[model samples]
Target: MSEKVSLLTARIIDNRRVAPAHFLMTVRLPLSFATPFPGQFVMIRNDECDGPLLARPLSVYGFQRQQDHAVMDLLYRVVGQGTSLFSRMIPGEELCFFGPLGKGFSIPTGVKKVLLVAGGVGVAPLIFLLHKRLLPADGKGIMETIFYLGARTAELLTGLERLCGFCDLKICTDDGSRGYHGPVTGLLKHDIGGFDAGDTVIYACGPKPMVRAMGNLLQDAPFHCQVSLEERMACGLGACLGCAVAVRTGEGKTDYRRVCQDGPVFDLRDIVFASPAGP
Candidate 1:
């Protein structure tokens, strides 16, 4: 860990529901803290201490650096006990957190465009990636980006309006509650052919099935692709083998990688998709 990655207490600036089941929690960090890159995560310790036992891991959604203090935001859903607990935290509450941990997405030095593929709350890290830095767009080194978001309903499209301001957005809701009436992956497949594969990159974060599905779809493609694997992680520093990903090694050999340390971000080619078409 670096000098900045300490277990620190943060003051909740705001915590509110942004969507049907999604919530946004913003905290003010110490003046010494640095903003986390996209896909990096924080371990939020429960206030009850022993009830939930371990802290919940959340990806950095957005952040802003101030003259003295910095503010970081976490966008999460009320999925289980850990997250359910976070949903109830109020402003002014002190939350213990340790983070800016884990590997993050990597954009090539020069790219024509970037396709951000998000599934529901997966929008969290991708948005952070966009806001954290700029990617080289053309030979002249400009940047261009677009988002392909998928959800079951419009209500599940968290942070859609905000993301639109940063780049072009194409939405797909299963029930046709939003922009397109098909899966988001369909949008990616439809538009990916427009750019020069060598000059384009795809950055994705979502459920395993979606990531797996994308992995399968792009396995034979020319574009460089990276996917952030989501897993139930314990001991974010990699002390325990709590979060492991199946990786392809040799001809048929398979290995496991710890998501908390080695990556939440990984090359799409290295992963062994559970489904031929992925998840």
Candidate 2:
């Protein structure tokens, strides 16, 4: 985790609808603001509004530094009151935010292949990761990158333009309106045999069902898998115990971990998914 978490204000530069019910908001940040890693997020709220008391946790979609200030893009879906308000915000309006919070995805050494999986708006952080990996500051050799994207419908899929010409992009839509006619996980499962698990790493961010299904698919596999969880967070800091997840301890016991502070990212094998309740 980054040691510096600052409470700052950003001026909205653009807020445009990208997909149906999805908006891509661009904001300008202070030049001194620390850059956030992939899977890390920010807590934001309308500075002028008094409603929606708590700040909403949003993943960093895209980031770039300019001469005088930095720019960040936040990709969000209008699901409730907070995001509904965000959709109506215009340029020059300021938003209060605090973060670069939660742990992010870490790639291990000697990995030859990288697989990025995303579902719906969960593609936000994965896009950030893709940008960094494609244009790394360290000038390291690029790995074989493959991206699997899934959405409920073709209209709801965003970021396709940015993803093209960058990696091996595969897409799936639930309604057969896109590339594959099934879930993104199913696409990955079908193509996963091409790579050797020992030197491959998988990073995923999506809804619970998609993630859970991925977990089950790779539970006994040798590939290194990490998942970014989208849990409800009241406070970005550890003080609020709102985002807790269950994991297996070394002794095979179930223990709880905080998603806000400890991770939005975790080893896929470490998570313990609860069974669906009986009717």
- List where candidate 2 sits over 4 angstroms from the true fold: 134-141, 275-279
Cα lDDT for residue 200, model 1? 84
lDDT of 2 by residue, 141-185 (tens): 388888899999999999997788777889999998989998999
lDDT value for model 2: 0.89
Q: Which candidate is the best by TM-score?
A: 2
Off by over 4 Å in 1: 1-4, 135-141, 250-252, 275-279
Candidate 1, 125: how far from true, in Å? 0.8
TM-score of each candidate? 0.92, 0.95
Clashing pairs in 2: none
